[model samples]
Target: MQSLNEILLQKKIKEIRFKAIASIVCGFLSIIPYLGVLFALASWILFFIVLYDLKIYGGTKNLFKNLFIVAGIGFFGILINVSVLFVILKPRIDIFGGLYFNEDNAFLAIGTFCVLFYITLALIFPFFKAFYYEIARVTKQKYFINAFWAYFIGICTLPLFGLGAIGVLIGYILKLVAWIKFKEFDEQEIVNLEERLAKEQKKVFDLKWIKITMASFIILNLLVLVFIIFQYFISFVGLDYNAELYIRRTLFYIATILALLSVFLFCKKLKTYKLFIYFLIWQGLSVFCDYILFTPPSIIMSKTAYGSLIIVLNLCCIILAFLFFKSLVQITKEKLFYLVFIFFTCNGFVAICYTSLLITLNHLVFEKLFLVGIILFQVAYFISFLIFWLKLKGQKSVKIC
Candidate 1:
């Protein structure tokens, strides 16, 4: 019979294999049109599982704990900034007429928000550096350093078109190299490292529950996709406004409910990261606000009130997308760069444009622009997915070992 240490070592090896396979799969699936998001979400769960396993069995608790602390602080800073903005802008919000900020007030608010945003960035940078530095140290490779610099440069040159893309591509390449090296670490060293973990007993997670939850999530996503298709078809057919609104609202509400349930289940099972929960909260609120807006009599709210609610929801969605991307980067780093680009260009831009549309609903030009934006967004996502699938299919899978 195998000794306890041997059993543990085998388990760790299996997990490493799983993580490598998952990363590869995620990279491949990220190119698929609408389904890429669902696959990415699943990959996030797998990444979290790998992290948890590493924390418990690989003696990397401090590294993960510190990373989580930094992430939490960053999230908190964003919340604080948002709260402050709300406070500053509340008086300027004319419930009946919408935002009425004068030129001076608008400038002041923008300046203040920018200052706070920079401060938050400054505070978060060191933590990220430390995290990357540790990964490099563990892997005994300088690729992570390359990734760090590349990503930093990318962020700095974000205003430039081609420059940012180049930086991102370089960063992603380095990150992939680092991850591959980390996965190929000496087995004896891993066994030695796990010795320290033996002293601390950890609870075993039920694999069955995880499978069930994931299955449910997949089903919910499919339902959502169906609803989206039907709704789009209705729009294309030029249905009556009342009929279209009713169909859209009903399908949207149902889809939202299913999405919320799936997210809740995943959170309950994982219980580690709060990013998913934060997203769920914002999503639910957004749907609720939409409900209010679409309901008859306008729920006794003025146009300004409805618009503000939509704006808030869109802001929350933007934050949610940022968190999602951050979480993916934490796991895949450079390997996620291309998908990250697609997400920002498609979903992220959609959110921003939608928010702008909500803010200027009265403007015919803005309304027309939004319609065009939506079509472009869909096309971009589809093209990205096709590219990913083609590239992945063309490549041969290399053994991790």
Candidate 2:
């Protein structure tokens, strides 16, 4: 028996090594020009390798069960890329843009799409892994169905990817802690506390930590966005003005530092209520800084280049503020009624600023088009949110009454 166990473990280790090598090879193959077909083959090979690796571990049944989930996600992604290519390229007669495509622009589009897709997949992969592990741990029958439900959480939570990344990171930490806890439980005389303790411990992962981590990421990404906007305006609008760009760049750095410090404080694991209070304080100060520091000078230095910066700043603040409000609802367990009002008000502020800025710049069509998209998103989200709120309220009221 001991010899057999040793052989099994060696085989598993070898399988893991092979899978890792195959994954790396496939990653490299994906970047070669005119090799997308080969890349797809490598991706399929990588998928099988992953499955084989899982089987070599204790997760053979899990790989079998959740195969559909793995296939569905990957296939959908490839399908969307294909759809986009067909839609964009089919109309243009330029071979680079069409059936015989050969332009740098076409290659650029393909490369950019591939990079973005992979980055998105890399970010969300952990959630899928966690869900698979949980399904195997928690259920004995209908493994596929259970795994699908868990995976559905990831799918449904797409809009919250910015926030979900925080949850997923916490989930990774919990995974390590969970393994330790599982070992501890296995050694204990008492076992009923396992699930209870697992859940109770997660309270430490409450909303405050999530908010701070998310805010830090958003701020950093915003800085990158600002730089890209600066470059675009400079390139296209002939706004080769260096002083304006320098000021905006300096402000972006300042915001990034503040965001980092905010994240550090949250990492210290302060009490949730205290952290919430600090969040309010920081945001209030941010508003002050925005009005006093960024706004006045941005206006006084008004030019086409600066206009883009103002628009970007306004968009970032509005979106971040909306997310903060959403987090408050989730944390405070408040009714969604209040959130609707808040969302509208927040977006109204964004629209007003955007319109006023565009009007000041005399850009009518651009402002109108942007406002249309904003209004549509808000309206659609509002209606969907109302339905959800009503359903939740009914469920609660029935339980109480």
Candidate 3:
């Protein structure tokens, strides 16, 4: 009994020390804003050393397996993020002014890439760790790497024409299957830990409440439908100036709905749900913030200043969207990775051209260009819908046949 008491006291002391060290480290990391990349690198190095020591001391096979799993997740995250980044930034090598793929620019780009990498690890590592505990002896990090590598190669094999798009779909399916197969975790560790803990972790958001609230909120937003109807009426009646109010009101109402969705999404604990939610949120927030912060008079200071601010904000939004997707891939829905990547990439490209498109479309000739762009967007949407339908049909046929 005395020996058991001593052991318990020692364990308590160790836990206290561990928590204190963790708190200090977290405090220091939080203090540095842009230094998160450096901070994460340091944390990872420290983690490896500590884990190595722990593995040696315990001689636990599970520890080594967990190390592999985490490393694999890190690799998967880095590959997916960097690949999408390459697609987005590759086209702007010449036109973006400064960084023409020079060494300094390259270093900056690589360093910036770490921003996404670190953000992903920070958010998902705990989940992976928790998952590691749950899966017990069956969990191995190599499985995740192998799964990701296979998916990467498949994507690389995508055909250059529209078949490339089909390749993306197949690649997505392959990745999804791999993850599902590899997600074989044992809940024994979690159950055992729960027996020792004071309390179990509580669910952050209730799904039932979420559903009910969203449905009600969506119903309330039908007033925006009325505003949109009023806009057509004003436009048809030749009240050109009144039509501007209708348009503004219509957009504002849409923005409000988007903002609400974003808030609900932001509150969500899952990344995939947050991804689409944040996308709408950013769009809504940008429009709403711009309306409030930059009236025409405020933006008339200098053309460069206005342009620079908008560019900076748009870039910030793109980064946020990436972070949102990273969270989604790691957390809520891993299957949505390719779709999320393509959607964000397409939207980011649109944002980059949005202001220019607006400026040019003020001319009569550009009206045709605007119409063409709208038509193209519609066509792309229809094509995507058709592909989705075909894939669904294929899935059903496979299940049946």
Candidate 4:
């Protein structure tokens, strides 16, 4: 009979294969109207995770971090592309600075739009190149380049109308094919590392409670965010604005409190869970200390003065936090990367925003904007954070590999 390790390894291999196929399905789903961005986001994240999982099979180092270029740059491309899709659908819609193209000026508008769009595509091509090029380099899937070229050619021929459309379709097909072709991995390598791999699996297994608690916390947090966002649409006509605001704020606070409680049963033995706790504590302390000690209204004489103070405070807190990150805790680079890139960077932006805004007793916009920023940041971080746990959830039971 096969040993338990052998059986578990078999399951893991099968899971890796399943996830690759699932990623393709998600990519396909990304074409669906209305929900396309959601599906595409899921696809991008899932592909990142699949490569991370393939680490065991391919033994490729820094597989996820190598794509930092893609993630960092691709993020902007996402906004640009989403804007393009909007323009394509609503060609005459007002864009930046009261600018728009209208059917009334069909010929000129069409020509101008085509040129601008080609320019847009031109900007996007580098992102596409980096995306496929890095994947090809890491996964050794040379055909990925063919997909990139197909997309490039498609964009180049886009001004050609009909022919360009075919090129784009071909590119997508090749992309899907490339994604589906990841079934082969070095099975022998996995067999060689069986013992150590088993240990890794066990470490992952011990993290199950953490995974569940975090998942609950994230879901509840998102629900609260959505609830708050919907309040922006409420028609408070003939209603007491103060009462409505009170109700909205009360519900939000309650939801947040419940989200915190859902994760209270967490195991303290795993230092991993403390990672988020410490980061949050760092945020709270930094905000309180910086706002209190440094920025008294007497010192905030000029706009420049206020802005300068806020920037210095944020940077100092960040540098101090980095020191704590280095000395007070043991954490992985990837985890540290998330803490800095997502949480700390976001907090810095929020702090700077608050300082720049002119706040008065009656001006609630600043407070609302801050709340929105906080929720948006949580949404961004939790998406990736949830994926981290899911990746670990696959880990079966042992000691550190």
Candidate 5:
């Protein structure tokens, strides 16, 4: 006969395992269309249940409190989304189309809808911050603070784009890690976890190739920024359209090739980094998509096919970023490392958006907006990278036992 405490420990372990499995399943299901929503909702329900159980089973009260906060904010976000969708769709439906509203009433409704939309958008980071912080506490890893900031910035910049997807993906992976760590704690196997973590951190920190790879990544980004600035400057100076187009095309091909090479080099040195491999695959696919886009219409696929492929590639990039950030947090205990990665992720999305708008939108207003947006984003990215670079340069390798 097992003691009461032993029985409770076993039950807690089982619950943790179930949560881990469900998190992974939800991650995969989130990439699916339509069905993804159902799975996401189910995951939230499970999360609440797990948090409640943790509270009841001698787990930290802060975990429950933080998670409840996240749930409340997330629920409000969902409500805002639903309400906005209803407002937009109502005018399209036949029943509602027949309904008439005066100018004042219509303006009021639109203004209210816009306000709600922005409010929901603003809540994205807070929700991620609360969720990640709670997971970090459960895992007992101080480095998850890095993950929390990475995800917060990633989602806040582009809530519906690849950046937000990456944040969510990373959060799911961290959730799985938390479950695993909790299970180990339940089994009393975590006594040496700190020692092991220190060893792993030192080993990773002492790797010269990783330092070199990181430097190359920073240089590549700088080069991309330079080319982007040059490309836009020429346009503003009233250069020939063909000249601008050629420069833009060259920038794209060069950046894509260099980025792919960097990934390959990093993988060659750090084969254990599976997340980097996933990111490599994503960049490769994106390069292929770019190539297809530039190909002649006769040789290229249909518009619908191209659009679908882009969507899928964007989703892949999100998952890759998520995994990459999670892996970085696991290996390097530096909070600044996460911040640097967040800037890189944001820059990537901004570049992609700029390219997309340049190709698809011919309106003068949109072009001006793209130019301004890119400039602002580039400036911010440069500052972040500069700070990160200085920090990296000053960092000394930790000695491993």
Candidate 6:
């Protein structure tokens, strides 16, 4: 049989590798033209995760300490940049009839930003130098040495414009290779805390995300149900069509986000990163269908054809949702999965009912009955959440915080 240390070490290595790839993608995506700032912010979150996993792998509390500070500063810089763009620029410019940014104010902002940038750059370079050295030491990867020099030379030549991009590009490519070359270490390397490693693997669950998503579903669904019934009796003025369409579209948007966050928590515990990614794509496609069903088409198509399309689409949605929950059951090996599954399935049906009944302009009495069904299905949401909480309480290893 394989040794316990061997198993644990492999798991750690796999996790680090997965996180490294995610970080790399986020890092590159941070450079994309319009999306850069958004991804830059996201990249820092992944940066923390990458460093966190590496810290665990190396079994040291103080590993990559300086890099952590650099990450924090980088994140802070993005926020400050955004603040300057929004708060300092546009509002003042509008107040001054677009003349507030006359040369002096622009110069002051640029000068202040430069002073801060150079000071932080001086500190950031050294942190990265130390960070690369430590990675080389721990992983026995000398390519990190080359990575450091490439990155160092790149930043130093940023004043030379495109010349710097060459070095920075090489640096990132080398760093990616270095992560791929990372080796698995023995579990005894955790300062001989193999027993603790076993408990650490018991899994940590974040109930906060769960509760938030559940609350969003309950509140949004109940509101939509109420609005559907209200619109039946009291038509909205200045509204050409049902308001339910706009609100339901909003629900899909919020639910898309909440659902992803909730599923991410599940994936985090299950270590199913790839699975979460697939679900993200599926969710995206589902939302794309939302626009298709809610908005009038640009091209020619019969109403019968469109309605038939929606039925097929929603049916497919229910099936995908079914498989998602079913997979959770299989992976968790928890019978309690079914309750959550039922909650999600009922929510899916509620969505179908509300959208269809609103589109068809059902009688007021029919809408009232649909509202009653919604309130009853909400009970399943509470029951599933209760089961989740009670299950966590049963586990001695889980820290609620």
In lDDT terms, how accurate is model 4? Answer: 0.56
Highest TM-score scorer:
6
TM-score, every prediction:
0.45, 0.25, 0.33, 0.40, 0.36, 0.62
CA-lDDT, candidates in order: 0.57, 0.47, 0.45, 0.56, 0.55, 0.63
Model 6: per-residue lDDT, tens digit, 1-401?
A: 87876677677777677677667777888666533543454455566666766665665455467766878877786567656644444445465456454454666666556565566577677677777787677666788799889988886666565597889889988888888888754334556555445556676544666556656655665565555556655656645455566776677566556656655665655556655655555575576565676566436366556655666666676677567656756665676767766775676677576656554653444665665675566566555754553354222344211
Model 2: lDDT to the true structure: 0.47
The C-alpha stretches of model 2 lying farther than 4 A from their native spots are 1-137, 140-192, 195-212, 228-233, 236-401
Worst 10 residues of 6 by lDDT: 392-401
Winning candidate number (lDDT): 6
Tens digits of per-residue lDDT, candidate 5, 6-124, equal 66556666865686567567657756653354345445545665565444443334665555566687688778766765565454434644754344456566567556656765665
Q: What is model 5's C-alpha RMSD?
A: 19.9
Write down the worst ten-residue block by lDDT for model 2.
Answer: 392-401
- The TM-score between candidate 5 and the true structure equals 0.36
Candidate 6 regions off by >4 Å?
Answer: 1-15, 22-50, 63-68, 78-112, 148-168, 184-262, 265-282, 286-313, 330-394, 397-401
Cα lDDT of model 5 overall?
Answer: 0.55
**Which residue pairs show backbone clashes in model 6?**
none
| Deviating ranges (above 4 Å) for candidate 5 | 1-213, 232-271, 296-299, 340-364, 378-401
Q: Judged by lDDT relative to the true structure, which candidate is superior, 1 or 3? A: 1
Better of 3 and 6 by TM-score: 6
State the TM-score for model 2.
0.25
- Once fitted onto the true fold, the runs of candidate 1 whose alpha carbons sit more than 4 angstroms away are 1-21, 24-34, 83-110, 156-169, 186-191, 194-401
Pairs of colliding residues, candidate 3: 68-141, 69-141, 134-186, 135-185, 135-186, 271-328, 272-328
Clash pairs for candidate 5: none
CA RMSD for every model? 17.1, 19.5, 21.2, 17.1, 19.9, 6.8
